[model samples]
Target: MTLNAETMARFAQVYRDNRGAVYAYLYGRAPEHDLAEDLTSETFVRALRAFDAYVAGDRPIRAWLFTIARNLVTDEMKSARRRRQTPLPDMLDESRFVVAEPDPAELVSAGHARDSIRSSLARLGGDQARCLVLRFFEERSIGETSTVMRRSPGAIKALQHRGIDSLRALITTGAIAP
Candidate 1:
């Protein structure tokens, strides 16, 4: 599909406006920062390439960007599965979590607890991670998260419960203090 000048402008605007949020979203999904950067770039490229096909009311562009990013992550997961090996965790030491670059004011206000929370959230299995992020971080409704995560509502709820439980465990262990 061809993105005419105006559509291209709109797509670019959307990309610029929401890029950071999308990057942070992908950062939580990807195994490494470099992979997250690549995936974020691919997401924008795909969104630009598919701009003309994007209907006005199907969903917000932010949500649509996530849909694209999710597809890229899914494809990565499939390839990883075919290779058949246990992937390494990004955070081997809890100390690495504390050494993050100086955070923004909002993150500071949210407190170190949020970073701890995100770290725990990141530890969830893929579907649980997807469900938790979409429902809580992205503020998507249960139905919307189910649609994006491609699971039944019951499954999402179950994952959400387990994910929160594991996060609580992380908190209790002092791996991440609230």
Candidate 2:
């Protein structure tokens, strides 16, 4: 589709507004910065290609961008799992390379905390977990999250409340660190 100058300007504005949220959403799911960056870029590329088909009043722009990011991350995860099924050659064994590792006990501890939170999040219902991530981690408002999840604002609020309660319970039970 040929994007007019005005259409291109609108796309640029949307990108500027939502880029950080998209990147954060991907990072929350992917963990690796480089992988998240790649996914975020791919998400925008796809969005740009399909921009002509996008209806302005159909949904919030933030929601549309996030949907794109979520789909890319899901696809990337599936691709990674498929790649894992193939075994590496014995000659390229990582154990053969005696690389000096840095002593970062503090960093390891922080990572453990993140892992614990992720594990706790996994135990929540899909809707609840997603609401929590978009609301808290990505710092999206209730209205914005509702649009992304395709739920009403009230439903999003309820999910966020339940998700927070569950996270607190997990922390209290030592499933995750405070």
Candidate 3:
């Protein structure tokens, strides 16, 4: 379906409203800031391209948007070839807000911690890493994580437990410092 003026307006509003959360979600999984930004751009491009197929009542708009974002990250991790990232539709630039940047020293400390956690998560294997990121970094509820991951809430709970255990082991072994 062609995005009529109304759909175009709605899509633009969504891009403006949801970009930051999408960026943060990608940021936790991406290896670098630039890749997260690139993935954020690509998520909306794919969302709009596939918009015709989206049925509004199937899920919350944020959920749909995140589903797109999650798939892109997974694809990026799996693919050898890098796809070109797309720019946002024209009007999105106008409404973007500037936030003060974090301190460089704190940023370095946080980046090290994040890398350590990610490394531990990688060692844990399976969906445990994704589960922890969704639970903690993304600030998603157990039910929301279950929906996003297509797992049962019980399964998510189990993954969370296992992921935490793995992280604790890493800390104990001096794999990651407190």
Model 2: residue 18 alpha-carbon error in angstroms: 0.7
- At residue 177, candidate 1 shows an lDDT of 26
Candidate 1 lDDT score relative to the true structure: 0.76
lDDT of each: 0.76, 0.83, 0.83
- As a whole number from 0 to 100, the lDDT of residue 36 in candidate 3 is 95
Q: Write the per-residue lDDT of candidate 2 for residues 42-150, one digit (tens) a residue.
A: 9999999999898869767777888888888898898888785565677776887998887799879878888888888887647778889888768799988887888
Give per-residue CA lDDT, model 3, range 48-93, as digits (tens): 9887778988688878888888999999887825665576777756
Can you rank all candidates by lDDT, best first?
2, 3, 1
Compose the digit string of candidate 1's lDDT tens values, residues 65-154.
888988998898789778977768886777757776666976666656667777776765466666777777665677877887778888
Pick the lDDT winner.
Answer: 2
By summed lDDT, which 10 consecutive residues of candidate 1 come out lowest? Answer: 169-178
Models 1 onward score TM values of 0.54, 0.72, 0.60
lDDT of 3: 0.83
lDDT winner between 1 and 2, please give it: 2
Q: Candidate 2 local accuracy as lDDT?
A: 0.83
